[model samples]
Target: MNEPSTIEKGGAEFEGVKLLLCENPLPPIDETIEAASDELPRSNHYTEPYSAPLRDLLGDRIGVSTEHIHINAGSELIRFA
Candidate 1:
């Protein structure tokens, strides 16, 4: 009998684009620094699962429902991919 195949899908079947990571070229602004400092106290806690506030803002600007918004941290995206 033939052995079962371990490979699930071939490379040609990949339908997603590859994303690359790079260091930020710009320095943080005063507002960015202030926000980071403010959040430092809550650094130990995990961020909201869906980042509702940011999603809400984006949804309003784009005329889409919050349910259509999907947010992911840069590190999480890289790790998962």
Candidate 2:
């Protein structure tokens, strides 16, 4: 048997689906916009494998070494890890 369409599977037509909790409705602050703009020149480069700067900063704030810190792109990546 063929699989049903999304509307058929859902038993109604869904014009769209929005996960409001997944995003911030407010616009980014000036500092964030400026920082992002500054990084545009280096956007072609791949990010460092370990994100050492971020890890170091977080480790310093929490009184831990970088070895103890782990950062994942998202919950989906963490699930695989």
Candidate 3:
């Protein structure tokens, strides 16, 4: 069953908040937004299918086959396979 709905609080949240209490300093919001804006044009195309290269890099670091790797599309998609 779901942990009693924190939907009552409203807005975007990381599911990891349930598991990890972090106090790490986040980067400046304006710099982050500017960096994202630099990649805005690429959003016009379907790029999810293009993530294999990233998975390959991750697999190399972890010493696993790329075919065995998976990347969640977003925090909302995080779950056991």
Candidate 4:
């Protein structure tokens, strides 16, 4: 993730909010696979696709339909005002 730009400096408008800035925090492929394995259901040898399971787990937390959720492989390069 990109660092907050000068415009996003903590100020009255952003008070009480927490921000997490990361350059690249993803673990290696093997580690990610191992972590995912632990989350898989033990009773079923086959598992649901990635998006479906994630949506089920995070159903109401984000307040948006799963169709609106997107997965990007790299950093988001665009910015908006």
Question: Highest TM-score, which number?
Answer: 2
TM-score against native, each model: 0.47, 0.52, 0.38, 0.26
Off by over 4 Å in 4: 1-50, 72-81
Per-residue alpha-carbon lDDT of candidate 1 for residues 1-81, written as tens digits (9 for 90 to 100)? 534433334634333333347655568899999999999988997667668899999999999999877876545643332
Number of clashes in every candidate structure?
Answer: 0, 0, 0, 1
Residue-level lDDT of model 4, residues 4-78, one tens digit each, is 433444553432335468544555699888887897767365434344667755666878777665443344522
State the lDDT of candidate 3 residue by residue for 1-81, as single tens digits. Answer: 676435424575545334336554565699889988998988786546437888989999999998788775566655666
Best-to-worst order by TM-score is: 2, 1, 3, 4
Instruction: Score residue 64 of candidate 2 by CA lDDT.
Output: 97
- Candidate 3: list runs displaced more than 4 Å: 1-28, 48-50, 60-65, 72-81
**Whole-model lDDT values for every prediction:** 0.71, 0.72, 0.69, 0.55
Q: Flag the better candidate by lDDT, 1 or 4.
A: 1
Q: For model 2, how big is the CA root-mean-square deviation?
A: 7.2
Model 2 alpha-carbon miss at residue 45, Å: 3.2
Model 1 clash number: 0
Tell me the alpha-carbon RMSD of every candidate: 12.5, 7.2, 10.4, 11.9
Please give the lDDT score for candidate 4. 0.55
